[model samples]
Target: MTDSNQISVDPNTRGNANLIYILYLVAIVVGITSIVGLVMAYLAKGQGDALLENHYNNQINIFWKGLLYSVVSVILIPILGLGILTGLAALVWYIVRCVKGMQALSAGQPVENPGSWLF
Candidate 1:
C-alpha cells in the first residue's frame, strides 16, 4: 500500500503549465481559446510550485493588459486611425508575453517580473 502521508510531486507540472501558455498563443490565431487558457491558469493558480505560480501570474497579467488595451483601441477606433495600430500592437504584445513565459517555463525558471508592463 502506498503511504498516505507521502507527498508526491508531478514531474509534468512545468510542461502542463507550459501548455497553457501555448494555448494562449494559439488563441491569438484561433481567437477563442484564450478564454480556455485563462480559465486553466486560474484553476491551476494555487496548485503549482513557485515557478508555476509565477507563470500563472504572468499569464493573468497578459490577459488583463490585453483586454484593457483592446478596450481602449475600440474606444479610439474613430479617432485619427490610431486604433488599428494600437490594436495590432496589443496583439503583438500579448504574443510576446506568452512566448517569453513559455520560454522561461521550458527552461524551468520563474518569470523575472510577472507584473511588468513592458515586454
Candidate 2:
C-alpha cells in the first residue's frame, strides 16, 4: 500500500530538529531560547525515524550536559577566578556540539554518538 519509490520522511520532525539546533545557537546571546529548544527536543523525541530520533537524543543530552558544565563554571568563579576560563571552554564546547548536530542532521544521518559529552 506504500510507494516503494518514495522515501518516508517526516518533514516536520526534521524542521523541528533544525530549529532546535538554531535555538541552541541563539541561546549564546538570547540565553532563554535553549530551554525552548530542550522542550521541543523532548516533545519530538521518538516521534520520527531513527535519524530524527537520534537528533532529539543528542539535543537533549546537549542541554542537560551544557547546563551542568555552565553551573560548574559559575561555581568556580571565586576559586582563583577559574570560572572565567571554564566558562569560555564550556561555551566553545556547546557551540561545537550544536554545529556537529546540525551537520549530521543536514546530511540526513543519525548522530554517530548521541550520548557523547565531547565533540
TM-scores for every candidate against the unseen true structure: 0.86, 0.88
Q: For residues 1-119, what per-residue lDDT tens digits would candidate 2 score against the true structure?
A: 98866532343557789989999999999999999999888877777888888999999999999999999999999999999899999999999999999999999988888899788
Candidate 2 wrongly placed segments (more than 4 Å): 1-12
State residue 118's C-alpha deviation in candidate 1, in Å.
Answer: 1.3
lDDT (Cα) of model 2: 0.89
Which TM-score value belongs to model 2? Answer: 0.88
- Residue-by-residue lDDT tens digits, candidate 1, 1-119: 88876533342378667777777888777978788878888888888888888988899888888899999989888999889999999888888888888889888888888999879
Residue pairs with backbone atoms closer than 3 Å in model 1 (clashes): none
